[model samples]
Target chain A: MTKRAALTDLPLVLDRVSLSAGATTMLDRLNLAITPGAPTLVLGPNGAGKTSLLRVCMGLAAPSAGTVSWGGRTDRGLGRRAMLLQKPVMLRRSVAANVAYALAQAGCPRHRRAARTEELLDRVALLGLAARPARRLSSGEQQRVALARALAREPEILLLDEPTASLDPAATRHVEEIILMASQSGTKIVMASHDLGQVRRLAGDVVFLVRGRLCEHASVGDFFDRPSSAEAAAFIHGELVL
Target chain B: MSEGLDAWQLIASGDATLISIVRLSLTVTLGAVAVAAVVGLPLGALLALTRFPGRSALVVLVNGFMGLPPVVVGLTVYLLLSRSGPLGEFGLLFTPAAMVIAQALLVLPIIAALTRQTIEDLWREYRDELTAMGVGPTGRVATLLWDSRFSLITAMLAGFGRAAAEVGTVMIVGGNIDGFTRTMTTTIALETSKGDLPLAMGLGAILIGLILAINAAAWGLRLWSEQRVA
Candidate 1:
């Protein structure tokens, strides 16, 4: 597969986005900008609209009255965008077939599609299980397959909603390594995570959401050292501040 | 004992009339099921996905039709398609097409209703996943229906069993014309009323066999879908 050139130039900007379902609010006037090649971590407790903000940024959920602009253009299609959910959805096909399907949809050529899937399988270390039923894989294995499928698109922006949510320590490290490698390749990575260790390891910056509102948007070093909000301080102290 | 054994010989010897009746029964049942599936699957998906003002009323109507009285359906269709009734212009009465249409009406609701239930249940899981993947409207609906293909197949089989084994609608609408629309169910009905006990019994055995086959298929689909869910 001919890998598409990396998007090392464009910025993803979500300005004053608010998402509400019925009367209850998900995201409340969240404003932030995401620079390419920087892994941004979204940290928040439950019910904070962390996932909702990612959905808005990925163009999955529309903001009630705000703009999600990619490259300063609100109307630009998110064609080169890819998002992974907490519990990834896999096709009922083989592991390799799942990757191939995503690559094909991303406009990879016929000959390139298979080779891309093979390379992804190797990268995810699931080459031996290429033909095994994807649905039957363990949770960690399924998560990797989902990652491989997403990266096969060679997306300009990668949005992950708790990609390592339920994985064990080793599994978490493996996923973190993949994200790091993709970030190095100049594919912008945006992740929502609860694990502070993971946030520290991968995110160049942190965007914190608290109760559907933006509490902090700062560099990783500054965020962990001197969080501006009491909620972030309480959260860093490992106290539940919801 | 002698009469029953002799009827078995008739069934085994490839009796042209019996063979044709059985084949016709299969055709009408499968044709109705195919048509019902095409219409009912989309209706089911819509019912499960959309939230309109009349949603509950529509659900109630569909659930009511799932258990609709077969004889009432037969009577209404019989009147409409009969020689003196509303849709008699094209002269579709007492024909295989009439049977197909009546049976499709009966079966379509069952498939549609059950498919709606299946999709509604799966929606809770798929809604977030599809949204996060940025699946658009058309793609979202199509993948939901396709992913639950096994459940829909079970729904169609359930419809098939009801349509194929039914007697009232086909007899009334098709008139059970010999060599034209005479099917297994109607043959059994005719043979019984006319006091040909042995032939009716033979047809009854065959009809039961067909029912068992269709139900087994439905059960298989259920099991396969269950395995996936598990």
Candidate 2:
């Protein structure tokens, strides 16, 4: 299916956001705007706060100094959003039940839940294993189930943190395809990734972080070809950004 | 012992007094379990999910209560139910109702503490997913309790075992009135004291059987659920 226009809201805005613990800063005065379109990728080295950034946007963590507004809606009103964490947790049930639980929590009507669950599992290529226990699945399969769960929410903004970090190349390809499809269908995709090759394939725009600071935000082509910041340049060249 | 063999013969003969004792034992313990579950399940879920000042201290207190001496509980209940005590107006001392109350009090802490541990471990795994799904605090607790249903069943069984086996609480509160409030544990105590070794041994065997039956049932449920999940 082709990506549809966003149904909930447009342009998640973060203004002067900062998350700090004691003296350690995780996200420092970062500002950005995300509108529905192509996928946006967040890239940074370990401890650079890539995961923390996604968490803040998901409203799992409060920004110590700034505001994150989803079309003027606060976290309580952001119910139409769903996130897949770096280490996704599977509900202790059948694969289909995991997706269905998400659907139920999202307020999907009871009568329609089964069909929705089947469709989501099919989209993630997990239909055959619908009756299998979710936690008993392989790590790659579990990730797919987590993705299926996120899609079951019919979310406008889908946040993913290293969704394919544990997958093999074949599994990674399958996941990347579904992500691209979701982006094409107009579900705004915001993701954190360490694999540069993946960024090349999925990112429409790139947000680069260096030690809790927003070093650069650029379109994939511009960011790759022109390379505005030294960190982005070094990062693209496969050099670690401290 | 030859007395153990004779006790089996009494069980086989299905003596009326033995039947009444067994029935009473089941009633009192099951009643205690039901009452404890009503209060303990919510308390445990609350303790597992919420955080406030003194929570740690409260958790320690509940854990400590699990090891409460049955004789102390008996004396405390006895005093409260005596005509000179605060709750004397109820006139519940030396009755089955009093026995149920004492057993419920003893079982509550076991159910609550085990439930807290089980649900807390599950909450750790489920917190992010449930939160991202927009589930509220109540929803989180309900979901964790359901997902951890197998472990919670074991907790209930543990409460039942404690309730059924403890003699001090029921003996003091029920007064071990023959044919009126006599339970298997209390009957065993009376018969043993009267030197009727065979009957006491029979009641003891029946009590052990009931406990084993409960554990076996819980084990079966765990297996069935595990298979269904897999």
TM-score of each: 0.88, 0.93
i-RMS, each model, one decimal: 3.5, 1.3
- Tell me the docking grade of candidate 2: medium
In model 2, the Cα lDDT at residue B172 comes to: 90
Q: B-chain TM-score, every candidate? A: 0.90, 0.93
List the global CA lDDT of all models.
0.83, 0.88
Looking at candidate 1 chain A, the ten consecutive residues that score lowest on lDDT are A1-10
Per-residue alpha-carbon lDDT of model 1 for B1-230, expressed as tens digits?
12444457767887777788889999999999999999998898899999999999998999889998888888888888887998989799898999998999999899999989988987777776555444566776677787787778778888998998899999989988989998888888887887888878877888888788878877886677556442
Error of 1 at A75 (Å): 4.4
> Local error of candidate 2 at A166, Å?
0.8
Per-structure clash totals for the candidates:
0, 3
Worst 10 residues of 2 chain A by lDDT: A1-10
